[model samples]
Target: MPSTDRRHDIDALRALAFALLILYHVGMYYVAAWPWHLKSAHPASWLQWPMLALNIWRMDLVFLLSGVAFALLARRAPPLRLLGRRAWRLLVPLVFGMWVVVAWQAYAEAVTRGAVAPGPGAFVLRYWAMGPWPEGAFSGSAFGITWNHLWYLPYLFAYTAAMCLLLPLWRHPAGQRLRAACCALRGWWMLLLPALPLAAYGLLLAPRFPATHDLLHDGYLHPLYFTVFAYGFLLGTDAGAWAELMRLRRRALVLALVALAAYMAARSLAPDWSEARQALRALYAWSALAAILGFGHRWLNRPWPWLAWANESVYPWYVLHQTLIVATAFMLAPLHLGPAAEPLLLLAATLLGCWLLTDGLIRRVPWLRPLFGLKFRRPATATPAPVRPAAEPIPR
Candidate 1:
């Protein structure tokens, strides 16, 4: 149960993912009117590139990283303790974040418009009532701030809880038997064990049960997300195999890109061919999973101190960045900053500001470090990678 070297590369990747999130949101605000927001006479056409580049893949990458992190947790702690930690890590933020941070966001807009702001309880009610659709709750409109982006915390916690429940099986002779069953299926095709169920649910049950990140639309997305999270956990635990895949980095990148391209094309055309889209989406997720492994294999072990620091800051940055993006946009909006310069500057400002602000608070208030998964730094200390013993390949 002793900690091994910290995976600074993976931390860099996490920071990378959240950085993409920041860019995406900032890009959307300037160019495309969100699904909820009304379309303007002049849309920021420049957004298509960033959107295409990151949109389809970021969530999957985050989940994959979550799985890797989970594997780490499993290695060090028992299920009960790990589950408790996950809840603390997620729920505390969800409750306090929504009630305090999101509330402030809502009030700022409300006061600016001379509208009545709701009390905290009413704020929760208003947010909870909308149900998860992009429109109002379940509809796919993106006009209003749902204040629900933090949904990942809760969704991930649910997935982690389910995986923990399965941990006993995952740890035992029976689990070995199940993995054997999975292994017997075939190369890469074994992904169907998790993917098919999710695909089925997304295709069949998603309409009725529906998986949504929205505050209001809660049907079945959590279970599916959890299922894939579990799969990633299992796959990533085999460090040697992961390392081997890392060595095949080029091959993995090619396969991942090919699958991702196919998936994107299908999504673009899916309005005409739904079935083809579904099939490709499943294929894309599976291929992406492998790509993640391959890529992680190549880079997850490298030590970069900045990545270690950025990784520690990713969660807090994520929590704070969206609001910052909105505020920065609004402030810049008044200056009539030329459209081209607007998004780029805003994105840069947001990243720098978030990093500086979070870093300052963490240093000034040592006790709050755990809230952001940061450790207080001593002048001469370098972060050792969080690794596992040779006997325990699974780290989470």
Candidate 2:
């Protein structure tokens, strides 16, 4: 059975995951041989190593946490009510984000690429009109619009709806038995069994679909993400599963590190070994996740002064971070600041923007709350009542 006690570790892990995402986007600007909306004048070849390490599993971790969050919320409300609330929370921001928050990113990309004339006013008019643009106008000009970094919102909302539709079966005795069997896995079984499906997906589906991130066409990612999401949901309240994670935390870390080293060596030394590399990548991804969960549960389960604030602020930070990075980079590129100073300035500007906009403007304005994935503040004049715990917001 699910515990009534709060999962502080899960909350902390989610916050940290989003924080890592912010850093990753900043790195994207400097990482060499990768396409980003904007790129630094002097790209660092070495940056790709760390970026690739993170790219393998960061979004997977986010989806897993989303499923864990959904499991918690599902325990508190009826399926229909939960589905309605999720749709409102997810879709509202997605619409608002694509139109308002994400517009700057698209405009910046088009302007940088010289695909469109450099005028914010004209671009906004054309963008909002949803008409075709010249080839190479922006990241998704072929589609007439782009969600950019906010793609996770619609994907998550879809998964939530699917799960809700299957709620009855999930609650059935057969489903419960299957979940229990998964949770009861221990030792090597815990590590190896979960990775088989991921490897299978990598071997079979990855080459065919190739991860467009455009909800409808992403065949490989849908199964991969949904599988991990289901893993999280199944393990959410399983004490035995968590205990096994904690017990294997050290070994998992070592395995993850070794796998990473082997994978990188293979990529550099024997690029033709596609099947072996794929299997190793899957192994490393799962091991890294297991190690992270184990360490987080061991050390982060207690409430800290910052936890409450982070839980509230992470969603807004996520929605705002990528645009800030792209915009800051766009503005800074012409200055000829040295590589070190330029990226540092960009990072500083992005963090300051997220903090200022999220705290000073978004949180303070009641009407602006829902658009950024926050609940409205209670009116000061209302009668006092016990505070109910808010459902966890899905991380972007």
Candidate 3:
């Protein structure tokens, strides 16, 4: 297949992943252990299982997909040009979202937690002045300003910039050897070997550095995420690797299930052995990632309008969804609605708000579009206003 032939499956998968994130953030409101911005009035222990199932691989899959995105862009633009474009694309949204979209999350959390007096407008003013908020306020109160979910944009931007420095090296013999090594992953090796580094990270660094998502101090994540990202960057352009993934799709799925089962069993059985738990967790995560990659390649390799729409709208939705969930949950929690109703209502409001804001507002507004990571809305060409034939030389 030509490199330019749109990878419809990857597009669909990306959309699905972000959608899952929104749902997962919603889950954070109810999960027993997640240190989300806010919690539901009725936290449920059962939420832990599903959240774990998704949490392990979700962000990793995104990092891999992002590398694929890098591969796609790198094919078209020169390294310097690509770096510039990426900086614009990622950093603008990061800044815009930090000021506009993400701060709301911090504000909402503060209000809900009662650390701040009740005033969105006033809190936004304080946020704009960029003072250190009360220590307990969510979203990096210590830093005085927080990027929250928009942190992904800056991280991606940084990674893209760093990769630019390596672009030239990738053509050298050593880089060629590295690419060869990565491309060689397939079959049983595909099922297991890529996970070793990740398992090692979990067992070793995770104990030392719990995920801060704070970029600067996040030891384990930097190595793990960047490595997977590099893997995606290398493998994304390699037809052999893609074919290998598709060919091993079923086995990957089987392995994924087996790994997940083993992980779950270990959690239940050991529940305290850090080594066993972390190892199984990594196994489960990587196998599941492989399974999704294969499965997406096999099944979702087609497109529809909704997929296109999702392709466009997903970033903004991601930017917007968590806040909506937090804001909505805060309002509804006081209603003392039963668990089922409250969660369902949160989902509905989140979906509706995201859709309305993304499609109805963001897509249509000329200025606001790019802030949410959208392209310029092409101006409708003006019709030739029914050209009247020069008035027959004006008979004048």
Can you tell me which runs of candidate 1 are displaced by over 4 Å?
A: 1-5, 31-33, 36-42, 49-53, 108-147, 180-198, 206-211, 214-217, 264-270, 370-396
TM-score for candidate 2, residues paired by index: 0.95
TM-score of 1: 0.77
lDDT by residue (tens digit), candidate 3, 34-136: 7788888789999998888888899999989999889877878899999988887788888888887877888888887788988889989898888667787
* Clashes, model 2: 0
Of 1 and 3, the candidate ranking higher by lDDT: 3
- Using alpha carbons, what is the TM-score of model 3? 0.94
lDDT of 2 by residue, 342-381 (tens): 9889999999999999989999888899999999885467
On the 0 to 100 scale, the lDDT of residue 367 in model 1 is 60
After TM-score superposition, what is the CA distance of residue 252 in candidate 1 from its true location, in Å?
3.8
| Maximum-lDDT candidate | 2
Best by TM-score: 2
Which stretches in model 2 have alpha-carbon errors above 4 Å?
A: 1-4, 379-396
In Å, residue 30's CA in model 3 sits off its true spot by 0.8
User: Candidate 1 — worst ten consecutive residues by lDDT sum?
Assistant: 131-140
Better of 1 and 2 by lDDT: 2
Better of 1 and 3 by TM-score: 3
